[model samples]
Target: TFRVVGHFNTGKALVKATCGRTFNSESDAQTFLDACASAGHVVSSIETKPSTKKPAAPFTTSTLQQEASRKLSFSVSRTMGVAQRLYEAGRITYMRTDSTNLSDVALKAAEKEISKTFGAAYAFTRTYASKSKGAQEAHEAIRPTDLSASSIDASREEQRLYDLIYKRTLASQMADAKLDKTVAKISVSGRDEEFVARGEVITFEGFLKLYLEGTDDEDGQDETTKDMLPAMTEGQPMTRQTVVATQRFSKHPPRYTEASLVKRLEELGIGRPSTYASTIDVMQKRGYVVKEDRDGTPRDYRVLTLSGTAVQAETATENAGQERGKLFPTDIGLVVNDFLLEHFQNILDYNFTADVEGEFDVIARGQLDWRAMLKRFYAPFKETVDTTMEHAERASGERILGVHPESGAQILCRIGRYGPMAQIGGPDDEEKQYASLLPGQSIETLTLEEALDLFKLPRTLGEMEGKKVTAAIGRFGPYVRYDGKFVSLKADEGDDPYTVTLERAVELIKAKIEADAKALIKVFEEDETVRVLNGRYGPYIKAGKLNAKIPKEEKPDDLTWERVQELIEEAKNRPKRGRRKKS
Candidate 1:
């Protein structure tokens, strides 16, 4: 069976298109291709079925964070912080919780509010057993302290969070949304393949009147996305409106957002809801992970379009692998992870952290002997650490790339003093070259080709001001060197040292020169060391590297050499910023 892509159209109005309904093969699909999507296919069958969508469970700590992240664009810590403020103001219940169970009074309040606001039919009081057995924090799910007012008069963030909690709590006690789903099976003129068109009509709003759960995967199509099918008989002929098959690629596992990361930890029992925020925060603080919005690279993919019994192939580009507010592992994170996995695989196992967490919980409840639990884990863990320290070689996360094509020097990618970098030739070699790995390029994933590409830098863009202008990657990052002065290549300007054109490099060079010219006001021709410059605050005097502030009352040009020296001495002797002079 082959999954072919196309659309179904009646011509009156655009109804639907899909990557749905598999055809027998490519040849069968091409037998009756429609370029304008005007080909005819008989409606073989139509079926409508009733479906009910249950309201999502009331907000647990993790669920709340996940939803807030998706709906309000709040980070996990931000969500927690806002919820905490709401709780403190007595607008909502405690922010931290694992239970989905609503208190008896809270449930009654939700029931009353749902009945009054949405009518008696919508009020279907329901109870949810907490999915997590080891529930932490408050027993009740996070909810509005008073359900009568779904929204509160507060700061925007707090109000938004409270509204969410209120709606979730109220919706949890409401009836399921009723839907009528219709599927039309169309028969191709010359093939056994069946063309399918789907439509869904929401018959009753129910809990949907208040809230719909936010999804982590935003690209996924939902049942609510389809419209009502056009009135048609089983034997009626239908014209295809739009049918284009854009290639779809399999996606890698998504990087974790703070909320999703919390959910995962909850699922694995690795950490409590209270610690989830701190756990994510600590990784970033330790430089193990970065929470950033990365503008993903663009790539081209093939497109197959069927127009009037003919297929047209073309290429289209898309921003691929784009991520927003996601946690990405740094180069050091990978290196450290690799080292830990090799030296202490047992301790690094996911189950180990979860089991220890459970053990701690047991100790807190006085069910397990705390000392006994620690002794069991500590003995083996300590032995492994000691043994590994003594016997294991240092882990640099080094990868020996193939020899350079021309020089035949062995290339290697590894963590150096500054950070992860590619190196050519070892210590014994007469000469060596090194280049720092580009941002988002990890030592573990750096390919030999990519590593070699790094060495292509230090490129000569052309001569400027009688000096050769060259761009190269350095310890700090990519920069351009000209006339004994270096200018960093700004990432925001989309400058890549390796691929920067001579024109762009010259533009940057000129911009830097213009900025320096504006900054330097005057030079002491006699001393050659002292100069008047416009610093960040205002005009200042510079003698070598030392800076002395030029008082507003005294003009810099009016100051004599002795006065300038006296001022410089005064600046040097004055109490350093953030320091104190002895009384």
Candidate 2:
């Protein structure tokens, strides 16, 4: 049964309570009441009038930060700290809010005061109204609760907050902060760049009276605001104002502080007014977040920078055909992302995420079938999960390439630029040069040391003896070798660099093969692709090559040339096997 507390002009109660039951009309409600009455039930009604209690002044420093901190799990101290600065420094309206409203009387008083303070033309013709919806109707917007409020004297920390709120409230009520906004959009080459400036000319001092007072309260005012700007009109063109062309790279993910987190949560629609504080608290406790400090010392810092997004910020932008950086995903996040991207790709779809959220809203209002909706979503999502897991082994093998932020290069080097590559020395073959050589087609002739020494290579090799097609070889023997080819170790490093013999060419090839082998060995460790086999030559019998025989026995044991030969024979004896099943 439902009861009505207040009635409307159409004879419908303005306030009604339905006691967990549905009512289609007044008649239906009447029938239920009649039934109850027949069964010995009694009903009564009461009338009350609304009262007019002045709401508290607009949010004050502590109050605003407290509410924001609680909703955002921001520390109380952090709330006041930022708010006080915003208030006294004039970055925002007063930080604290306690006043209930901006009195019509106060509004008129402000207008009169502004007209007297500045020229009458500078005063606003109409009152400023804050129609921001869903705000507590009785409470005032976060503004100066009192226009006549004076600058606060600093005695306690709380005074700082009071000063910020007071000045902002007065500032808001006095006038619109005048700004000489300048914007320039220029095209260079094929790209376009925009520059903007928010400057002021001949600032109306009336609003700034409160600003100045507040500035004194928070901290000393800076020189920028002390002088009035030169006057200028909207259409008038100004001088360059010192034009500058600066180079900048794409920015990384911004570090999140309490203030920024609140902003982001508001943007995502993930939390409501009452739940923000709890969310922040939980995040801190979970070890998923920490406050980053400016000087390595924690000085009332409250910003939270997610360790993962740090990587994502890199490789976000680049020139064409570049490998981007990988956003370091947490183990769990990586698994979830991969699974969602593969099996339930639709779940990753923006439309699907939105539709599901919308359905929840409908369910809350009983406008949609809850179980039916659940089933509809569960079926496809479940199928996708199953399919993903079934093929997880194969899917995990795929690699993704992205731009590297630091070098802006396609290849990623694990070690620093000075790290070695596997190679044989050619021109500058020093002792430390052994580790830097690697086998790959080069754009220029460079030794392993030279390549590693220089972080990057020129597009083409400039002036080097190795670049000449025919070079004379003397001392060791007469030989002619191509300029771009790797210098053969056997090549006579003498007067005649061009002339080379067949013996020298063979020696060079052998040296090249050895160098490549050493490099490959470094890449594969014992834990990775390493296996020991018996030597047919038997323990370095001489500085000569020897062939190892295949062994018998399919079972694993101590490796020997005889055993390897026997195992090879056994394998040949067995029937051929088919491929193993995938996944």
Candidate 3:
């Protein structure tokens, strides 16, 4: 429900109700509307107050990562990596720290810098208290090593990170920003319902002048709070232009981004500053979660086009396909999460995790025995693991989707060794044919109709030049087969092998043949032939045995022979990975 202020029918300003008040039923609503029409309303009261926003504390590791993710679009790992480089170069203090307390030397430097840059009025000398329960007071928060060394020669990414740190450190020593808030209570002439409107304006910039804290939302300020309200006194009459009653439902919690997840982990005391980036990295590397592009729009409604007219209808389910970077749990991740909850409840418990973290802190402070703590935790955990290993059922991702209508066989969706797949026969049947689910289909939500649709695989697209041509889904993706020659289908174009026509299949096969014939990109002046070809992991250029990945910023066709040679050399000189020996 919303209320707006505007001109009324009469030249004299007056408050009026527009939409019918909500009730238990339509009849009740009508009765209320009739009552409101007979009655009247007036401005009851108004209040204006002053509010102030205090400056945020100096950067902790978690807060720093959160800010970088929100403002610079930097991943937590990337931010830490650049910060580590800066720390190593003596440009910043230790990056891995939870304490918000600043050293006397650092604070004095910040005071000098703030006073010199923004004048004495903007300087704030009060020290901030550490909010973290486990913060180490011995270590200071992240700050510049030398405030005067603002300009430094660094990489583009390092420069941005340095700038952020410098501004944030200075802003931490600034005054609070002042705001004026106004709220009005308007009574309808004949209605019992009262409408409330609120607005606020920033009266003093203060710390906001140097830096405004970033939020998870792209817009740092709330729309309602940012709006400026006109001056009004108590009992001043207000004209209601319109009253809108919108049927709004509660929204589902948003998916976690890197910043939000770090914040949550910190709140729960699940991990320390140093482990935050590694924890997220391990999740992605193990395929428990995948970073993918998603649509930013939370689709709460579906637009239907009928008879050339578009109508928007509210929906519970969101539509797929929005472009933004976010992390999503895979089927395996869900399975693992459920399995851990069932078998290792104590280990996976939030309180248990936090308690263990507290125990580690105790050990760090030399107040507890580390070995005793480990022994107490390990005994039950080992026993549970041993018992569950023998009894727990394997989550093979198998689900019976009911019997097939015509085949009389049961349709089953399961996660095979490769990935999620569906079959059309019983477990003992040797002749069961399996097919992978369509790109976006999920086993959890697979219906009988959708499962049966998978049986239409290895589709024959008719003969091409007297040779039989077929299209089907392979391990990689959709492909067309003609006379034993397999041609991969490109979705960037309007091609889907699942629904490709005979003519399209023939054309694709021809294109594949042409492409294969010219795999050699160029014969360089150094007698090196650089060939661009598809590899197990996307597309790359091959010079001898060294393969160079095509950078996202550079197109394959735009590469020159010299650039190819340089890329090949770069790939050849790349460092090899191996386990590090403990010192």
Candidate 4:
């Protein structure tokens, strides 16, 4: 069995010993700690405090591309090129944003465009506003910098992005996207499954013309969104297409990529507009991550990172009796959570976290004293920590490893209720204790021999080969009653058979409709006026069954244009009095 990599917990002192390197400067460590303190302040402390300032700047090209790619799967290059064309053609304002606020001139242009394009009813009294407190209001919002200019013919890529951004921007400047949402609750095998559909009716396509997925900025709204369902009234029953029953195992914390990392940074309030890209670059350069090429028909590469904070937390716990500044969790994060909830349930109260946040908010607003707030929080938290340490049983630091022998590959085992057990691995011998992996596993782990063998088989016979019989499983013929009224026409049989080519089909249908018979066939044809010919009844007009007939002596040519015109005029000038009574 091949061993890939194994993990063990160790402290900073043990880490230095493992590397045979001495700690030279304690002050350097202090400097690093000071930087982390500053980061913490910016993240948890400052961001928690409310700001009354203007919003941040509008989205820059990179940020816009990143967001679009993250949310919509738009490529960065495609996003930039399309945004460029929109700006040049006067469809959208400048694509670049380092400033969050719109200028007076830009605001006026947007307002005028809104009024002119949508009308005053749809236009706003005030330009749309955003609530971002630190927004740079110098640059204009992502509006069409020039409203008077007309749109131009765009390049292929430009056309797509231009249409999307333009629609988003316009929607942003307009009203909320109105949608009627419906959810159908279905019962399957005694389980409640909900199928949802959303009928999104653009009541007003607002700034959505410029951007779609984001906090509703450029407008003063605090509404968040949920994936909506199609419109339907309550009590309306729906037929389910299929019941898909699937089993899912629990999952570990997901590894973050560049896009996900940026999302996390936003959520953490650790980084902002200009710093996101650089922070990703920094993490990559710091040896915390490694980028690998993805294997496929066309190969692409992406970065993968190991959490340094997680590693540090693992190491800190190894130094049993030493003061580790602040307590951290790593391999034991979930275990600690389970233990706290199972035993010390009251200490980690659900409402405790929210209350602590409330106290911080009060402090920031000068409604509560900061020192008192910290004192109240620390007393309980410190007591809980001490109790947990005194009462909780110790965890044995175990080095975990598992391997499958058949393919000589590493197995990703988990620390289960039993010891480290194989969760995934290569195929193994059934008799041995090795993990028995199934066939047709992932393509990435497939050997070259296996791949070549797949292509070696004849997937289909050559054109010259004899007829190959195959099972006819599903319904194969046109819908017909089984009462034997319809004739069975196979490849070898024929009855009322006609070639179904496009030309022949059209001609047949046309002939059927134009026949001197039923009117049903004429329903789809262009001519709405119907024609009729009679013998004994002569030529009778059937308009609403109020019939008239031409005399037998009168020829069709006798109805001249002059007489028709005179009759039309006479009808128009007729008196509105009651019809003359038949005498």
* The best candidate in terms of lDDT: 1
Candidate 2, run of 10 with poorest lDDT:
4-13
Over the stretch 1-583, how does candidate 3's per-residue lDDT look in tens digits? 2222222222353333233234444334334434433444445777779888888888999999999998899999999999999999999999998988888888888888888888888888668887765666567888889987666799999999998988888889888888888776667675567665567788887888888777776424653245565555666655434332223334456678888999999888788889999999999988788877865445453222111122222334554345466788877787788888888887888888788888887899899999999999899889998999899899776789999888688789987776778888997777887988877677788888888877787898899778889889877788898877888888999888668899888888888888776654444565545677665575688776677888978877677878887888888888987999999
Worst 10 residues of 3 by lDDT: 303-312
Please give the lDDT score for candidate 1. 0.81
RMSD for all candidates, in order, please: 6.0, 29.1, 7.4, 32.5
Ranking by lDDT: 1, 3, 4, 2
TM-score of 4: 0.32
Candidate 4 local lDDT, residue 215: 38
At residue 88, give the lDDT of candidate 4: 74
Say which candidate scores most in TM-score. Answer: 3
What are the per-residue Cα lDDT tens digits for candidate 1 across 1-583? 3345556666565445443454454444444354234445778888989999999899988899889998898988899899888888998888788888888898888888888888999999898877764675456788888888866789989888888888888899999999999988877665555667788899998999998888777577766766788876798767764456555566899988887888788888888878888888889888889999899789886656675566776778999988888899888788889899998898889898888887888898899998899899899989999999999877778888889988888999988888889999975898899889988788888888999899888898888767799999877788898887788898897988878887887888889999988998777667877888887898899987798988899886687878888889999999877756689
Query: CA shift at 454, candidate 3, in angstroms?
Result: 1.8
lDDT of each residue in 1-583, candidate 4, tens digit only: 1101111122111100010111234333233323322221100001011112111224444446555665455544446556767777777767654343456675566567767876755444344444332333345556445544434466766655655444434444454334333223321222122222222233344443334554312223332243323333344333322111111123344444445555444444343344556555554454333333232232222111122322121111121122111112223344445666765676466455435544555676689988887786689778878987888775422222334344544444223343222333333534323221112222224343333332222122112123321111112331111111221223343311222233332333344435535432211122234223343545532223233344457553354444433443554576657968999
User: What ranges in model 4 sit over 4 Å off?
Assistant: 1-63, 71-99, 115-122, 125-138, 142-144, 148-167, 184-211, 214-242, 251-257, 282-583
User: How many residue pairs of model 2 clash at the backbone?
Assistant: 69
What's the true lDDT of residue 462 in model 2? 26
| Per-prediction backbone clash count | 4, 69, 11, 37
